[model samples]
Target: MASITLKTPSLSYDIHIAAGLLRTLYPRLKKLYPAKKSFRPIIVTSENIWALWSKDVLASFPEPPTVLFHPVGEKHKRLAAVEKLADQMVEAGADRDTLLLALGGGVVGDLTGFLAAIYMRGIPYVQLPTTLLAQVDSSLGGKTGVNLATGKNLIGSFHHPLAVFADTNVLATLPPEELRAGLHESIKAGIIYDPKLFKYMQANAEAILAADPAALTKVVAASVKVKAEVVGLDEKENGLRMILNFGHTLGHAIEAATQYKQLLHGEAVAWGSIAAVQLAVSRDALSEEDANKIVNTIMTYGPLPQFRADAKRLVTLTAGDKKRRSGRRAFVLPKAIGTVEVVYDVTDAELLSAANSMLTLMKAQA
Candidate 1:
């Protein structure tokens, strides 16, 4: 097992990475937190996981803590749903001292962490992420957010969790598409911070897709460590964190164009990444080879799923991207594998051309 601590302005938390962690949750949490006369927990999960792993997790609690289950997916991540969860906590008599157990993937982690952040100004929470995406990226960072109708993650706050419980075994049950989608974020982390990881994936693409145990742990652990270091430095995203949105600015637009239902976040990001790479080269910020390397990485991670999306409408959606500024459609484009540039001055014509060019490349490859 490996451990990392995230120190942020509003919160501090430990990330525990290991296999078979679901069974150890009780004993370990009990040690980390000895049962006092007053301590209690409130478990928050998505409807998907509650049906799958609720028995083992709930049974482990001394007196099964209350769990508020939200219907799963990015669509449900909204203010109304969060308010409902907070109301449930208050109705259950939860206090600031009570711990929050977030027992699902990134959606639940983001929603729950945000709930914990706003509830009574904040409360401690644990992250038991079952999805690889959450295990590798979202579960470690204090960045919590919900989508607004106008933009993806247009509303959010930075609130770290008390602990992260990543159980790799749980991923074995994930749908193959979901598993492939997670690789997009993993690939983004590599592109932003660890060029060596990009090389490693190049060599182990087959094994990674197969989900070999050793590869899973190493990739997940390394990805988490990289994100942990970044968030530890800038929790509020006031400076360096925007680079984490590498493909996300345009990706969010792609998501919104599709109503966030057609493509997984990763899939949208994959295509969005395709556009980001082209923009970099078109602006001469990077060599053509660099763009090709990125495209290859996304392909190696997983071939982008086919979807019929309108190009012009997607470009319009970028105007509302949080990263956009001065009313320009912008993005974080890579200079190389491990570094990126956040350029919000990208022209609308450039964005549409890039989006169209990417669709051309995708079609050619398909």
Candidate 2:
């Protein structure tokens, strides 16, 4: 097992990564919150994941939990879903002392964490992220929210989880595309902080794709360590934490333009990373050599889905991104393989060009 502790001004929590940590969840929770005898566990999950892993999760508890199922997919990540789950929590006799167990991927973790954030003021929650994307990124960041029609994650809060248990065993059941989606985030982590991790993935792409346990553990643990250090420095994303949004500025815009239906979050991010690299090269912030390496690394996963949104529309959506500040949008562009900088000087025309470049790349690859 690999463990990383995230300490911020608001909270501190341990992220545990192991193959079968799901089975140890009950005892772990007991040790963490030993004084709360009346605390009930509400397992929030999607119908799809519930069918597959609910039995294993329930077996980890002393008794069956109050299971609340939401529809799966990014399209279902909305205020309506959160409201529906909140209603379920109310009817289940939940109180401030209740604990929410987020038991699926990012959507489930986000919705459940957001629900706990605002439910009767606040409640404790634990993240049991079942997907690679969630395990390496969303599950640890304390970033919880549902998407609005206007943009992605525009109506979210920074509600940290009490603990995160990432069971790599659940990853074996992931579809190939979902697994690839996660590799994109891990790639971003490597590009922004750890060059050794980038080379690790480049060397073990085949084994990681084959779901080799050792390779998966190393990739996830390395990604989590990068995020944990960043979050510790800037938990609210006011300063140093913005670098974590390396591929996310245009990525969120792409997701919004596509209505979150066609492209997975990490797929959009992979495309966005390509665009950011193009922009960085144009600005002379990154060498074309490094840019090519970054792009080639992402393309190794091969043949990302093509998006057809107008470049102007994609650029327009970026105005609504949460990372915008002082009337100028900020972008995290790479300076090299293991370094990035957040700048707010990018022009609108530059953004449009980058978006179009991403479209062209996707079409060519497709």
Candidate 3:
């Protein structure tokens, strides 16, 4: 097991990453949250994930604390679901001492963490991420929130988890499409921080895609370490944290414009990075060779699912991005492998041009 501590002004926690970390839940929880004092954890899981791993998690709990079932998806990540989970905690007579054991993917971790942030002002929480995306990105960050009427993750808070158990074994059951979606984050981590990791991933794409235990473990640990370091530096996303949003501005737009149905978060980001590279190169920030390399890198992986809805409306969706400030969208564009920047003065024309280029690339591939 690889353990690391995440310290922030608001909260501090430890993240345990390993192939079978869930198997250690019983012993770890007894140490972290004693049944005699703490309100114990309330396991909030989605239907699908519950079906796959609940037996193992349940067996570990014995008395098993309390359990809440939230619908699985990006769609249910709203105040309604958060409210429902909060209701369960209240119904069970949970107090501030209570902890929410978020046992699912990004949706569960985001919504449940929001519940912990607002429930009785705040409560402790733990993240047991089952998906690669969550394990590497969402669960590790203290970012928690849900969507609103206007945009995706527009209404959210920075609520840290008390601990995270990233069980790599659980990823074996993930659908291939879902796993592909997660690869975008791994790719993004490489683009923004480590060109070497990107080269390794590109060379070993097959093994990574096949969920080879050793490859997947190293890939996830690399991405998580990158994110953990960023969060530890700028816990509130004041500045440095925005770099973590590489490809996310347009990616969120793609998700919101499609109502979160057209593409998974990672899929949108994959294509979004392509779009960003186009803009970066066009603006003279990156060389065409670098742009082509990034695009070809994605092409070698696979075709990016088309998101050809409305470019203008999609750009408008970026207005609601979590990183927006002073009525400007903070767009992160790649300058080269292992480097990206958050540009605050992005023009609508630039965004439109890049998005159109991305559409053209996907269209040609299609």
User: Per-model C-alpha lDDT, please?
Assistant: 0.82, 0.90, 0.84
lDDT of 1 at 149: 89
lDDT of 1 by residue, 107-128 (tens): 8888888888888998877889
lDDT of 1: 0.82
lDDT of 3 by residue, 1-366 (tens): 788777767666788888767766877776776467655678889888888887778766657667789987788898988877777788998887777899998899999898889999988888999888898899988889999867888788878887899988999999887887887888889889888878888899889888999999888888888888888889888988888888888888888888888788888888888888988988899988877777777776665677656888878888778777887778898888898888889899889988888787778877
Q: Which stretches of candidate 2 lie over 4 Å from their true place?
A: none
**Regions more than 4 Å wrong, model 3:** 9-11, 33-37
- At residue 249, what lDDT does model 1 achieve? 70
Top TM-score prediction, candidate number = 2
Could you tell me the lDDT of residue 145 within candidate 2?
93
Per-residue error at 366 for model 1, in Å? Answer: 4.0
Q: At residue 328, give the lDDT of candidate 2.
A: 88
lDDT tens readout by residue for model 2, 277-355:
9999988989989998999989987558877799999889999998888888999999999999999999999988988
* Lowest lDDT 10-residue stretch of candidate 1: 30-39
- Kindly indicate the candidate among 2 and 3 with the higher lDDT: 2
Candidate 3 lDDT score relative to the true structure:
0.84
| Model 1: how far residue 28 lies from native, Å | 3.0
Q: What is the lDDT of residue 329 in candidate 3?
A: 79
